[model samples]
Target chain A: MLELEIAHNWPGFQLQLHLTIGAELIVLFGRSGAGKSLTLRAVAGLFHPASGRIILNGRVLLDTRSGINVPPQARRVGYVPQGYALFPHLTVFENVAYGLRSSSKEVHHRVMEWLDRVGLADLAGRRPHQLSGGQQQRVALARALAIQPDVLLLDEPLSALDAPTRSELQALIRTLQRQLNIPVLFVTHQLAEAVLLADRIAVLEGGRLLQVGLPKDVLHRPARPEVAHLVGVRNLLRGQVRGISPEGLRVWIGEREIRAHWDPAAPPPPAGADLLVCIRAERIALVRPDRLPPPERENLMEGEIIRESDYGLSQVLLFRVYGPRLTPERDYDLEIEIPPYVYERLGLDRIRRWTIAIRPESVHGIPCG
Target chain B: MDWFPLLLSAQVATLATAINLLLGIAVGWLLARRSFPIRDLVGALVTIPLVLPPTVLGYYLLVALGRTSPIGQALEALGVPLVFTWRGAVVAAAVSSLPLMIQSCRAAFEGVDPELEQVARTLGRSEWEVFWTITLPLAWRGILAGMILSFARALGDFGATLMVAGNIPGRTQTLAIAVYDAVQANDPTRAGILVALLSIFGILTLVAAQQLGRRLAA
Candidate 1:
């Protein structure tokens, strides 16, 4: 387990955070300059914050009030910085052997063991520049893990690889992470990678953490407007609350009432509170002309596809609703996404007018100023 | 065919290079890795010798280590006086050659990626270990080149050695001073021999440094 609370005042960004990680992979997801890498460095003891307390497995690594700050050498945390930062002069075998403090015999054994673990045993004699980027990344991973550190911190490790190699390493990382019971913190800006690797996703923006929850929850129900945008929430509409109950919130959006999910743990918003309604592009489904309406309470609206972009496997369509339009000034109200096969099967190219259903559970709302 | 001056020059240049090898690397690494309030001032001070006239630098050294000075008196009491002595020539040569040595070492150390050293530290190596294992190995070629530059500079130094060590043929007179002595005495053969040797040696060191620098770049 790794727990850290850090507060730092920098020129443009102020870092304030309190987080705990158990024996699981937690992905720190954010946009560029959102402090994801900085947070990982802080945990690795490479970056120092003005005030913070970092505790790993009951051992205090940093406590500002008590003035206890451990040097990185003794912290025993594995850190693979962005680009791997592998020593250019060292061979792959030597790089992995670097962190091991055992006798020569034991070091050689452990080094070769980790090399095999990362599937690089045969490339041990090769230098970093001689190998591919993915191969170098594996060497970096083996080097960090060979130390048997209590925690592992990876910063954008796979961001520089080809798609095939990236997915290959992603599976390798997930499998390897499961074998080690230490807290692992991974940082990435790509949401798909985060969803694939993380057991929990922590959304961060502008030096602050917006929310932390399971991948599905963070993707479907972001807690803030910035997070909604970062996680690619397709439609964010200005709305006013009409009513609230155990059922959900009935919010008015541009001359129409749309139902949105409301958490029961918090007090319900007043009937007239302003809100930002978040609906995902993938959650809005097209209704075939021959089929009946979607299940109960799922919003039904008539909209015509205005513009479309073909993304090979998935197709995105701009949807503009009929009478009492959501946005009268614009040509589109909501953006919807469906696979290409579905588009052809539904004959969406031939039929521009369509009915779309938005399940109330998929539409989330955040209180607005 | 007097060999004393030749031998003395070799000893003085060799000893000066040794001192510079140690002092240059330390200062170079510090200058490259650290940022302090007086950083620019310190950098300028070290490079001043490269631009200053040798005679002017010799004048400062003479006063700083003259018999009337505290350091000179302290050394005198310790039975190793420097004024008009061979040791004074070593000091003069070292002062003049130091800047080249420092610049070479500074550039070499600065060329090394700091992230390599940081990663070494995170790998459980102490700062001292990292310097030996990572920094020194990576920077040795440049440092060796600097040492050679300093040795050549020290070997050819004439104005500063004359200003401080003075011309005493059997004692402090070095190769450069002896050449001057030969010319003053109208001994063309002696001056020609000494000049040929010094010029050849200076050319060889420069060539060797060029080759080493090329290899370092590659």
Candidate 2:
């Protein structure tokens, strides 16, 4: 287990992060300058926190109260910085052997074993510049693991690779994490990458952790509207709670009513209490106008296509509601995502008027207060 | 040409180059990696010998290391002497070439990415291990070029060595001093040979420095 409670003041920013990571892959997901890298630096003992304690496997690596701050070299924690940062002048074998210089002959064998594990054994004699980016990353990983550190910190290790290589290395990292059974703190801003690799994702913005949970929990149930936005929730509508039923709660958004999944853990809101209902774009379904009359649930709405775009694999459709009272005057805008296959089958490109339905379970409501 | 002065000059230049290379690496690494009070002042001081007239530098060294000065007295107490000696000539050449070594070395060390050092540190390497296994190896080409430049500079040193060590035959005289003495004595043929050799040495050192730099960059 790795625990860090640090509060440091930078030039124009303050970092107060408290987090505990177990033996699973915990990804620190954030945009650029969100302090994810800084947090990793603090754990590596490269950046000293003005006040905090860092504990790794019960060893206090840093504690201002006790005046015990281990140097980066003595921290026993391996850090693979962004770009892999392999020693450019050293060959792969020497780089891997670097950490094992102090170890016994048995440990030297282990270093070679790790190089083989990372699939860079054949390239061990080559310098870092001679190896591809992916190969360099593997060498870096081998070197870091040679010391048998308790915690492995990776800062955007795959960010520099191409898409195919990134995926390959991501799989390798997952396999290595399971094989090592050591707690790994992976940092990345790519939401898809975080979702694919993280056992638990910590969403950070402006130096604060907005939420931390399993990927499904965090994606399906964000703690805040900002988190929902950051997580790529395409539709977030401000509304007022009308009433609660045995099924779920009803919210009045603009002149329309919507039903959202209710969390029993949340405090009950009054009838007029404002709330935010969030639903991911991919969770929304688009129906032909001739399918049938709208459902009785508050989620069904009639809108006209305002904008549409297609990526190679997916399509995004932006819609604006039509009518005298429910015109585009309202602040809420709805976006829907469709797979390429669905886009072709529905003939969505040939029509402009459609009914959008958000499943009740897909809509998550958080009290604005 | 008589070979005595030529051989002595080569010996002094080689010794001075070797000493300058060692000291240059040490001082350059320190200046690049460390910060302290008057660091800039000390850096400027290291280059002062390069800018000062060689005669002025030689005169100061003579006064500082004369038999009466504290350093000279201490050396004398240990039964060692540096006054008007070949060693004194070497000392003057090394001082004159110090800036060349330091400048090249500082640029080389600064070109190394600190991130690489950080990676080494995280890999359980000690500070010294990182320097030797990573920093020094990476900067080896630059350091070599710096050594060659300093050696070439030392070979061409004249006024400083002439003042401190005095132009003694087969002893303290170097290539530059030999050429100066040949010119003074109206021995134009010997002087031309010595000057031609000095020019060839300088050009070869420069070409070697360029090639080493290119190899390292590649």
Q: In order, what lDDT does every prediction score? A: 0.91, 0.86
Q: Which stretches of candidate 1 lie over 4 Å from their true place?
A: A245-247
Candidate 1 residue-wise lDDT, A1-369, digit = tens: 899899999888899988999999999999989899999888777888999999999999999999999998999998999989898888999999988887999999999999999999999999999999999999999999999989988999999999999999999888888999888899999999998899999988888899999998889888889889989997989999999866688889999988889988888899899998999999998987677465556888987999999999899999999877777768899999999999999888998999899889999998988
TM-score of each: 0.96, 0.94
lDDT of 2 by residue, A222-278 (tens): 989878987888778778899988668887877877788887767778899988888
Q: What is the lDDT of residue A322 in candidate 1?
A: 89
Error of 1 at A297 (Å): 3.6
Q: Is the docking of candidate 1 incorrect, acceptable, medium or high quality?
A: medium
Q: Estimate the overall C-alpha local distance difference test score of candidate 2.
A: 0.86
The regions of model 2 sitting more than 4 angstroms off are: A101-108, A288-298, A323-332
Residue A117 CA error for candidate 2 (Å)? Answer: 1.8
